[model samples]
Target: MKILLVLDNLSSSCGANVGIVYELARTWVERGHEVYCLTRKDRFHDIDQQKAGLLHMVWSFDVTEDDILNNVTKSDKWIHLSATGKAIFELTHPVFLQKMIDKKFCESSEIRNEYRKQIEKLFKERSFDAAVAVTEPFYIADALASAKVDTDKYVIMMDPYTNNPSTTDRTRKKKLAREQHVFESARKVFTLDFVGNDMNYLSEELLGKRVNFCVPKVKKCGAGRSDDGATVVDSEKIDFVYVGQLYEDIRNPELMLKIFTRLPDNYILHFYGGGCEQIVDKYKEILGDRLVIHGWVSSDESALAQQNAHILINMNNSIKNMLPSKLIEYINTGKPILNICQIQDCPSIPYIQKYPMAVNIMPMDNDNNIVTAMISDRDLETMAMEVQAFTENYQGKIVEHDVIENIYSDCISENVADMMLEEMQK
Candidate 1:
C-alpha cells in the first residue's frame, strides 16, 4: 500500500508521535510498500528526509511561521496561534484565499477557502492508499476534508481531542469541533493510549465511534540482559540521569533538585534535553559541579546516559493513562528506574510496579519517604533481572513489518466502499 502520513513536524526526538511515525514509515518501506511522509520543515531544515532507517520519501511543505498567525484572533492570547496555524498551513498553503488570509488579514472563511483549494491540489497530485494524521487539535481536519480521500484512507489521530490543559478553551473547542467533523466522516481514528484515554470525546459521546487503540512500538534496540541481573556503568562518578524536556510538564526540575540535594557528596545528577529556564539556572547555582546539564542530546546519547547512570529518574506531574515514551528507552537500557508521578495505573507504572528494579512514587508522598527509598539498598542484580525481563517481553511483542502491513492493510480494507462512493459522487 502507498501511504501518506501528515504530522505536525518530524524534526525533534521530542515525543512518541514522531517516534511512531519514524518507526512505521521505515518499516513500511522495508516491507516494499511505497511510503511518503508529508510534514513541515522545522529549524532543522533537512530533518524530515534525514530520519534514517526509514526507507521512505519525505516531502516538507513550504509554509512559514507567519503564514499561520496572519488572521487568527487576538483574544486567543493564551494559545500559540502561530504554532497552531503552522500545523495546518502546510496542507492549505496553495489556496489563494488561505494565502490571502496568511499574508494579509482575512476572515475564517477566506482562510478555509484557500486551505480547501490547497488540499484539493494535494489530492490531485498524489493518490494515497491511506492518509494517517498524527494528533493535535484539528491539525489534519482541513487537509483530510480537502483531500476528498476515498473512504479507504486511514486517519490516525495520536491525541485525544482538546486534551492539552495548556491550550485556551477557544482553541481547544475549535480543535475539538474540527475533530468531530472529521470523525463523522472518517472510517476509523487511532490513538496511542488505551481505548478510554484518547481525545475523541465527541466520537464516543455523540458519533459512537469507539476509537482503535494501537500500542506504539518503541524502536528495536538489541539491548542485552544480565543473568545475575547486574550490569555496571564504568563511569568516573556515580550518576543519576533524568532524560526529558525542561518543560513544566515533565522535568519538574525544582522537585528533582530538592530530592537529589539530600544525596551524598559523591553522587551527581545530570539533565538532558530542554526545559524550564529558571529551574535550570537555580540548580546550576546550588549543585555547582555536582549537576550537569547536557541540553538536548540524540537518542544514542540518551541511551548512553541510561547505561551510565546508577538510576534513571522520570518525573511527571501526572501520568494517568498516558505513558511517557521515554520510559520505553529506559526499559531498553535494562536499568533500574525511579518513577515519580501522580497516577497509579499509568502505562509505565503498572509495568514498573511489578518489576523489582522499578520504584514508582507519587507526588503525594512526602520528601522523607522518597529520600529514604532512594538511600536504601537493594539487590541490584535482582532489580536488573526484572528490568531485563520487562524489556525482553516488550521487544518480543513488536514485529515491525507485520504491524505496518496489518495497520495499512486494515486502513485500505476498512473504508474502501465508503470512500469510493464518496469520492466518485463528488
Candidate 2:
C-alpha cells in the first residue's frame, strides 16, 4: 500500500500532530507500505536513507537545503505571500482582522491554485491507496478537498474546524456548511479525542456523518527516574506539579493562582514549560518561593518531575473541543491527579472522575463564592483535608487498584490500527 501523510510542521518529537503522523507513517512503512510526508517544514531533517527512499515531500515545503535525500516527487509550483503587507490591513476593519487571523497561512488563491495543480500532477504520477491529513492549519484538508483527489481521503481532526472557540460568529454557518464539503471525500473520519463516546470532533454532524474516534497505542514505559537528591520540590513540601505550556489566551492559570492562596504553607507549586514568564510573573511575585517556574525541559525530564510530584495538576484550556496531551501522561503515572475545570463538562473530568486518587475542581456559581471538587464540601478546611488525604496517603493506598489497573491497560488501544487498517484493506 502507498499512503500520503500530511503535516503542517513536520518533526518526529514535537507536537501531538507530529507524534500521530510519524507513528502512523512508521507503522505503515514497517508493514511494507510506502508512506510519503507532505508538509511545510521539517525541523529534524533526520530522515535516514532507507526511510527517505520510501517517502516523498509534496507542495511548497522547503524541507532543508541540506536534504539531498530528494524527497520531492511532484510538487513543482510555489506561491509565497507577504505577512508584512497584510499587517497594515489587519487593523483597517473587522473583516480584515478576521481575514488576517483566520484559519491558516495557506489561504491565498495562488497557493490554492498551485495546490490544485500539484495535487492533480502528483496523483497522475503515483498510485496512492490513501491520503491522511490532520487539522490545525486546516489547509491541507482544504487543499485535499479542493483538489477533488480521487483517492481514499482520511481526515484526522486534531482540533475542531467550525466548532473552534476562536472562529468568528459571522462565519459559523458558512464554516459549518463547508465542514461537510471539506470532508465529503473522506472514506473515514478519525479523531485523536480523549473524550469518549458519541461525540464528533466537529460538534454537529451536518449530514449525520459518522466519525471514527480511535485511541492509539501507548508504549509501556519503565517507572520514571526518582530520587535525584537535587530537587525542584523540597520533597518535604506537598508538591503540585504542572508540566506544559500555560497560554494566556487558552489555558490561563489566574484561577488556579487564586485557589493557590487558599492552600496551606507546606503546599508549593512547580510549573515546567516555556514563554510562561508573562503569565506567571504577577502570581509568582505574590507566591515568591512558593512558585517554582522552570524553562521548557525535555519530555523525559518533565515525566521525571511529574513522577516526583505529590499531585499532578491539570488545567482546563479555554477550548472545550481539545484535550491536553499532558493529562494523558498524568493519568498513566497512577499519581494523585488534581484536575482544575473552568468549563462546563470539561474533557478531563470524564477521564479522571473514576480514579480514586483523582479530584476535579469543578466550576461553581460565583454568587456565593465557592469552588467544589468531587468530594463533599468546598470550604478551605474541607479542601485542605481532601488534598491531604489524596497526597499524603500511603504508596498506592489512595489509588483504587481496579481503576488504576484498568487505566493502565486502556492506554494501549488497538482500535486505531484496526480501524485504519480496515480502511486501507477496503
Candidate 3:
C-alpha cells in the first residue's frame, strides 16, 4: 500500500501534530507500506534524516528567493479601474501587500496554483492507495480536496470547530465557511477524541453527518527519570507541573498564578511552555522561590517532567470539547491529575472522573465569578487540602496500566492506518 500524508508543519521532535504524523508514517513503513509526506520546507528542514527515511519520499514546498524579490519590487500602478482610478490602487495596494506578508511572500493564489500543479505532477508520477490531510490552515486541506488524485482522502480534525473562538465576526464567519467546505469535501473525517455513543452535535451540524472520533494512545516513557539518573522533581516540596501552551483566554495562566500564590509554602509550581513569561515576571516577587518557569523545553524533557511531578495540572478554562495533548503523557505517569475546567459538563470530565487518581475541578458558578471565587483564601485552602489528600492516598499506588492502556490502544496510528487502508479498499 502507498499512503500520502499532508501536513503544514512537521517538527523534528514528537509534538502533538508531528507525533501523530511521524508515528503513522513509521507504522506504515514497518507494515511494509510506502509513505510520502508533503509539508513546508523551511519549517521541517531539520527533521532527523534517519527517521525521515522511513517515508518513501518527503516533499517540501516554499517560495523561491526570486519570487520574493519579484513580488517585493513589482508595482501595482497598472492595476487601475476607470471609475475609481487611483483611489482603488490606494485601497487595494495595502491589502495586496498585507496578503503577501501574511502568506510569507507566497500569495494564496500562487500557493493554490503551485500546489495543484505539484499534486497533478505527483498523481501522474506514482499511484497512491490513500491520503490523509490535516485540517489546520484549511487551505492545504482545500488544495488536497481539489487535487486530481484517484485515492480516497481523509481529513484529520484534531480540534473541533466549537472549541475555536474567533476574535472578530468576519473571522468567525470565514472559519466556519472553511470548516464546512473541508468537512463536506472529505471522503471521511476523523477526530482525536472518543466522543462515544452520544453524537457530537457540532460535528454533525458542520458536516451534516456523524464522523469518526478516536482516542489517542499513550506511549509509556521509562519510569519517571531523566537519562542522568536524577529525579525530575524536588523531594522536599510538592511539585505541581504543567507542560503546554498558556494562551491568555483559553488556558489562562493568571488563574494558575493566583492559585499558586495562595497555596502553602510546601507546594512548588512549575511551568514548561511559552506564553507565561509576562505572568511569571509579574508574580516573580510574590512567588520568589516557589515558582520554577522553564519557558520551553524539548519533547523528551517534557516527558521527564511529567513522569517526575507529584501532580499534573491542566487548566482549560475556555475550550470545552477539546482535550490537551499533554494530558495523555500526564495520565501515563499514573499520578494524580488536577483538571481545572470552566464548565461542569466538559467532555473530559467523565473520563477524568473515571480515573481514580484524577480530580476534576469545575467552577461553582457558570460565570467569571468562578475566577474570583477560586482565588479566595477559603477556596484555595480547600483545594490545597484536596490535593494533599489525593497525593497521600495515591502515592506509590500501582494502577492497572494495561487496563488504562486498553482504552486507547485502538486509537494508535497503526490501528488508524489499518482502518484507513480498509476504508480505501472498500
Best by lDDT: 3
Clashes of each: 11, 0, 0
User: With candidate 2 superimposed using the best TM-score fit, by how many Å does residue 388's alpha carbon deviate from the native?
Assistant: 3.7
**Which parts of model 3 are misplaced by more than 4 Å?**
43-45, 63-114, 194-210, 220-235, 368-376, 396-400, 410-413
lDDT of 1 at 423: 38
Error of 2 at 223 (Å): 11
Per-residue lDDT of model 2, residues 364-407, tens digit only:
44322223333233544454555556555532223433454466
The candidate, 2 or 3, that scores higher on lDDT is 3
Error of 2 at 254 (Å): 1.3
lDDT agreement of model 3 with the native = 0.63
Cα error of candidate 3 at position 42, Å:
1.5
**Local distance difference test scores for all models:** 0.53, 0.60, 0.63
Model 3 clash pairs are: none
Query: Would you estimate the TM-scores of all the predictions?
Result: 0.68, 0.74, 0.79
What is the overall TM-score of model 2 with all chains considered together? Answer: 0.74
Instruction: Please identify model 2 stretches exceeding 4 Å from their true place.
Output: 42-60, 63-118, 193-209, 214-217, 221-235, 275-277, 366-385, 394-405, 408-414
Residue 125 lDDT (model 3) = 80
